[model samples]
Target: MKPFPVATALTIAGSDSGGGAGIQADLRTFSFHRVHGTSAVTAITAQNTRGVTRVDLLPPESVTAQVDAVASDMRVDAVKVGMLAQRPLIEAVADQLARVSLGPIVVDPVMVSRAGSQLIDNEAVEALRSRMLPLAAILTPNRHEAKLLAGMDIQTLEDMREAARRIHALGSRVVLVKGGGMPGALRGTDVWFDGTRMETLSVAPVDTPNTHGTGCTLSAAIAARLALGAPPLEAVRLAKEYVTSALRYPLAVGHGNGPIGHFFPLIHD
Candidate 1:
């Protein structure tokens, strides 16, 4: 028999034609951590550093086919769950997740955009909260997403902690309330809660307009480390550091907002 793979990770996300976010960024992140990556593409997006122009969603059956094909053939050590744009897709993915024994599921709730836009309908959001959140081993949500999940505003660090607490009650084993949208020094401070313990994760904010794939990168990094056998909290901490370091060297790729360099460690200029 041949030697086994180092580790394997699966990304259930959309496709970004820009190659800066979604499955593209996720696969890049897993590669950076020396983990093998597989993917189930839920939607194909026409987008760039500027913004999304169009999106063509795949049928839930097609998404499930990809997921099943991977789960059946490979040993998925961890999973990074991203945008399921509708209630049907959310419920479908949730069902597939229940059937698979894939390791840790790091869920980046892509319910709200950085610009404060609701990406999904109320029913989709409800499906995510009711069906998907409970399946998450780690739920990473930005400020707006945290507010929506917790039903409160997150204006301070304590508010973030409380949001973590409230979202934890929603059934995710752990909740990470990201502070990337927070003001002042609070930015880049993420709160992690696992029902019993609450820990604050603060990294110096890297100011850059090239933050296109940050949310995707962070969650993918966490899943990569988890695939490599890191504990939940440690994985999150390391993922945040990875994202922070990546942001220090943003990729000036497009006309509008650029993207964070996924391979920044190899970038010398």
Candidate 2:
């Protein structure tokens, strides 16, 4: 018999040797959603659970070549972009992605830290906001990132809504301002805005210290659902649900923060 049909998704991100985040987490999340995963790694990080020791970025040409190799051979049903840490890499990936035909592109804006620190340079931030966000089907930015992008402080739920609106104006088809870093009872409440429809996506916060890869995992799950032909809103909803459940089954590995249970269904604990 012929091989079974399968949906394929591509992750254009960095590698986490720790296996908690970056390309490793993305592929795991894809597999959990039953989507075949492909990758074009932008950086290699020498790190484990505790922290990153070093990072080496792949040449922009090499990154684009990997993308070309995949696109020429197979149909990429969806694309998840994460952690393009500089201007050149950000522009290159955006150019390469535009040249290829892919499904919903989930842009995980990883430019700001939870502590309100700017993780990327101003030029890189501008490049991502200009090149990547415009191509994004869904742009996922956490509290601090939304603060940077929208040029406003996010201290309340309404602030999140405003941030989402501002980001949506920047051309992303949809903007999801993640509230995981928000204060008080609003922590797990996510604000979604798509120019027209706006709503808050909320779930009871999962109480787990092993929340490593949460951002990457959630975006990857969204891309996985997109690969499987789910509508944008439905994909985000499903991904959120998946992340919440996986957090409940957190893995107790690593010396520091560990990964959430990607294959939660298989764990018999």
Candidate 3:
């Protein structure tokens, strides 16, 4: 008998040729969750596990066309958006997603790379907040991005809570302030703040240097769980577990940073 059609997830993001982050990581995370994955490339990055050397933003029309094509044919249950390079592109993606009525959107506010290179421009950050956050089901911003969005320094757990509240007020129904960037912490803590309540999800940081794709993997896994009919909190829980495992079995590639083992279980398979 033919297998049943898996729930589909669409990733609107950049292409990371390194196979560690961006569209590559998104697709791998979806596959690991047993979901069908589709993509609309918004930008192309000359990047590896080491760093992003260059970025080329795809034309806004081309980006819109890809999203339209995928939405027209596929039953996209969830979307993970990342690495929109410019203001016009951000606005275009927001517009296209609105037109298609894409549900269960997980916005990973990817601003900088693991190697400390700025990914999104200054103006695009504002555009992202105004154009995209309102439509997102959940906004996943790392501590630094959270600070940028909340317009203040988040130096403590209390600050994280306040930042989450402020970011939620910006229009996202849920805000996940990722705490991996916080100082004096080996255990990564993610604070999930829905309108009604706040929950802290903590995991001991995997002792590995190969963490090139953690954010993209986490956000995409959440999208996959959402596609599989999991609630927001539950989705985040599962995604965190997956990311921790991935980090534990990171691929020992590249001279600088290295990619996480997305198919870490494939050795058994």
Candidate 4:
């Protein structure tokens, strides 16, 4: 068989040894969307479907070199950025992104893991806000991350909206505040706040314990869509739908929370 043509994407994020989230999830999501995915690993995580045990951040120069090598050679159409562990690393990414001028950047503000591990430190949040958000075409943050960024509790749908607004004001072009953690809701609800408008998207929540990489999957799927020239709203819409289906058919792989079935279509079809 002839090799598939390269439809490239760049993921600047951490590596998950368990292959469920972080760089692993991002690459799988991109490939599922028919794009060739490249990566610049920001950190190495000792984790599984259960949770993250430890994380060692890559040095700033190493991170920068990986990005530069890919950007210089590949026809990268979109970029997805995940966990940057410290201030210098965040700034380094920001600086390299500026140099490369990659657009339709998807920034996932990964704070705590699904297993309740702290991915980003308190000091790094400000750097992410000040240095990275402005470069993103869209910022994807779960409810807790939105609350931390907005410096307020998001207990209601109204508060979610308010949080999105504040996040938009913090230099992101658009904010998609994921409401998975919101109270009184087991449903998959997320709100997208563009500068002048707000939209709510919801799906019937799947009953499963395999949601470890949903956030990373969503952002990478969006980047893949954008690489194929989809608009922002459409990109998000398709990505959400894709994630919903993936979650509906999760891989029960580990002792604790497992991975979503990234190849669900192949299994089902």
Candidate 5:
């Protein structure tokens, strides 16, 4: 007998050897959401919980080829994009996206690492903002990334609102400025805007140092929800809830910062 049907979500991102971020985290989140996961790796990183030590980018053609091979055979219901490390990769991914009409693309603009290190160059940032942002159905940028894209520091809630508005003007159907990195009580607050109405999603903060893949996990969950036929607002809400629950029980494996419990439902204490 044929297997039962399930929604499929594709991730176009870098590979994380540590299984905590990038494509690894995205695919893991997709599994948790019960969506069939597919991926096109743009770069590979020698990284673990400690940090990224080295990075190797695949050729632009190779990236596009992976996307092509998947699109030619499989039915991709939704897509999540992350960590295009350079301008060429950004342009290539943007070109591929423009060529095919994929379902809700969640752009998780992976510019800066959680530890405040700039992962991509200035030119790549411009490329992402100009080329990739325009194609995003939902653009998920944390405080630092929103600042970079919107050209302002995001410290207060008002800053997040303004940043979301500025990013929305860049052509995304929706913009979510995550305030997880905000100081004190503002943490875990996210501002969502879609040109006209703006709202804040406030969740009680999960205090854990093992939040390495939070960003990737959130975007992937959103894509999975989109694949499962949720509207944009509902998808974001579900994704936020998933991330918060995962953060409640983090995995205690690595030496440094660890991963959230993507399998929390199965292994919670």
Candidate 6:
């Protein structure tokens, strides 16, 4: 028999001690999609289901070291970036990504927490917009993040479309503005734009308090699908489907928002 082909993905992000978001969630999502997962942790958060108590960023050199090590050895097929929580970290990540020829980069601009709190400073936001956005193959930002990136409030579907356009103009090949944070009927509806075309993607909203890692999971799934050789748009669609299915069964592990069920298929075995 011929040797099996390998699909590898890299996640450059923070470490979530809660095991619900950041690097933990990204790796889990990659594994579920059958992609080899590697990560470069940029920060470490002392957090749990309830909330984040503290956060410590790694030195810029350390972050770059991890990325260099992975890219030097592995044929990484895709990349997912999350939680570059500081300006220095963002700049470091942007610089290293520029040097390495990793495949499609999926950037999840994680600027705000699920509870509506700003996580990154204004300088960091600007750094990401100017330095990292241009390198992204797909930029996935939730309603709040889109608001910050696009410099406009996103209250309606039309607004999301506008936001996607503005963000895409920043140089990302495509933009996916998640409407999960929107109130009522608009929830779960994601606006997708590829500079020329715009569309909406949605699945039945799964009702659960466990949405801690939803953003990380979705972006990582997109990277995973891309690593598996799907085109950008198809990768986004498959990633959405995967997240929706995973959300169907929430793992009741913590008191606050828990993680999405990233390994449902394996759990049965």
Q: Give all TM-scores, in the order shown.
A: 0.98, 0.98, 0.95, 0.95, 0.98, 0.96
Ranking by lDDT: 1, 2, 5, 6, 4, 3
Q: Write the per-residue lDDT of candidate 6 for residues 1-269, one digit (tens) a residue.
A: 99777799999999999899999999999988889999999899999999889999899999899989999998999999998988888988898889889999999998986557898889999999999999999999999999988999888999999999999999999999998898788899999999988989987788888887899999999999999999888999999998998887778897887888898876644
Per residue, candidate 5 scores C-alpha lDDT tens digits across 160-207 of 999999999999999999988898888999999999889999999988
Q: Report how far residue 127 has shifted in candidate 2, in Å.
A: 0.5
Highest-lDDT candidate? 1
**Which scores better on TM-score, 3 or 5?**
5
Alpha-carbon shift of residue 118 in model 2 (angstroms): 2.2
Error of 1 at 100 (Å): 1.6
Total clashes in model 4, counting residue pairs 3 or more apart in sequence or in different chains: 0
Per-residue error (Å), model 3, residue 258: 0.7
lDDT of each: 0.94, 0.93, 0.88, 0.88, 0.92, 0.91
Count clashes in each candidate, considering only residues at least 3 apart in sequence or on different chains. Answer: 0, 0, 0, 0, 0, 0
lDDT of 3: 0.88
**Tens-place lDDT digits, model 2, residues 13-33:** 999999999999999999888
Weakest ten-residue segment in model 1 by summed lDDT:
260-269
Least accurate 10 contiguous residues by lDDT in model 5: 112-121
> Mind giving the per-residue lDDT tens digits that candidate 1 earns over 1-269?
99865899999999999989999999999999999999999999999988999999999999999999999998999999999999999999999999888898999999999778999999999999999999999999999999999999889999999999999999999999999999999988999999999999999998788899999999999999999999999999999999999899888788988889899979956
TM-score for model 6? 0.96
Supply the global lDDT for candidate 2: 0.93
Write the number of the candidate with greater lDDT, choosing between 1 and 6. Answer: 1
The positional error of residue 26 in candidate 1, measured at the CA in angstroms, is: 0.2
Candidate 4 structure quality by residue, lDDT tens digits, 126-227: 899899999989999987788888989877788888999999998998899997666567347899999998998988888887888899999999999999
Badly placed stretches (over 4 Å) of model 5 are none
Residue pairs with colliding backbones in model 5 are none
